[model samples]
Target: MISGVVVKHFLYCPAIVRITELGFEERVTDSMMEGEEVDKETVGNFLFGVLKAKELIRKPVYKYKDLVGSPDFVLGFSYYYSPLDVKYTNQVHMDHKAQVLFYAFIMEKLGFNVKQAILYYIPVKKLVKINYTNYEREYVERILRNIVKAKKGFLKVRQPVRKCANCGYFQFCKPKRVGNFYEREF
Candidate 1:
C-alpha cells in the first residue's frame, strides 16, 4: 500500500513514482535534503503550542486500504478534529494539501468534522489554512487511484526535464536538460 508521502512524491514528480515502483530507496546524503531540519523543528513547536491550547494527537497513523498516513498533528476539539501538517517551505504546495486532505478524508469517514487542511510554514511562521474543497478532493482521489493502478502492473515513469537537478535520482536519470520555465503544451 502506498502512503501519503509516496503519493505526495508521485505528484511532485512522476519520476519519483517510477523510482519507487523500481524499488529505489532514497539514500541519506551528508547535506540536508530540502526542508529536513525545518520540518522537524516546526513540528516540535506546533506540538507544544497545540498541546497547551487544546487536545492534540501527534503523528496519529491511519490506514485506508492502499493509503496509509499519519498527520503531524490532529487538533481535537469537543466534537471534531482538524488535520495539521508542518512544512518547511514558505508556501503551500498541492502535494501538501493532498497529504492533509487524505488524512481529513479518513477522519471524516470516522465521523469527525474535518472542514479544512492546515499548514504551518516554518520560515514564514504562518498557518496557510485551506478549505477541503471538492475539487481538491477529486484531485487527490485521482492521484490515489493512479497509484493503485500502478501497483496493478501499469505505471509510467515521469522524468520532467527541468526538475532533474534537484531530484535525488538525478545522477542515475541524467534527463535531458530543460529550463525551469519549460512547459509542453498539451
Candidate 2:
C-alpha cells in the first residue's frame, strides 16, 4: 500500500506515469549512443542523494520516467511522500540539466508540495539544496511546453540539445548523437 503523498505524486504526475516505466526502453536505448562525460564527484553526489531516499522494494525504479524526454533517475520518498532526484556534478551548473528541472514541473502539476531539492557536487563534496518554487515550476513548465510544441511541429520528434549527461546513463548515450536526441539504456 502507498501513502497519501506517494499516491498524490503518482496521480498528479502524468508524465511520470507516461514514461517512467521500463517499457520506455526503446527511447532509453537510443539515448545511450550520444553525449560526453561529467565529473566523477558530481556523479557521486547524485548517487548519495538517491541513497538518502527510500529505495523501491521493487527493481530499484527511477523516481521519474520521461513521458516526453529522457531524464536521469526518478525515485520517490515514501516517508515524506515527496519527489526526490539525484544529480551528480563537480560544479553547480544548471544550464545542461533538464530532466531534473522537469521532475519539479511534474511534481507541481501532480500536486506535491516540493519545497527544495538536493544537489550533490562530488568533487566539492557538498550538498546544494534548492526548492521547487513557483519560479522554478514556471521555468520547467516553459521547457516542457517548448518540447511538446516542437514535437508536434516536426514530422518526427527529435531530441533537444541536452540530456542525462551526468546520470548513471553515460554509458548508454555515447556511440553517436542522433537527430539531436536519443535514449540511453544499460
Q: Could you say which candidate leads in lDDT?
A: 1
Error of 2 at 133 (Å): 1.4
Give the lDDT of residue 133 in candidate 1: 67
Best by TM-score: 1
Report the error of model 1 at residue 157, Å: 5.8
Kindly state the number of residue pairs that clash in model 2: 32
Relative to the unseen true structure, what is the C-alpha lDDT of residue 128 in candidate 1, on a scale of 0 to 100? 72
Per-model C-alpha RMSD: 4.4, 11.2
Residue by residue across 1-186, what tens digits does model 2's lDDT show?
A: 112222222222222212323233223353433321334334533554656765422112233334332223333565432333333457665542334455455555555555655445445666555666778767765655544443233223223446433333234334245666643222
Model 1 Cα lDDT, one tens digit per residue, 29-103: 656754575565557566557545367776788877656778887877566567888887788788888788888
Candidate 1: give the clashing pairs.
Answer: none
Superposed model 1: Cα runs more than 4 Å off: 29-53, 150-160, 172-186
For residue 120, give model 1's deviation from the true position in Å.
Answer: 0.5
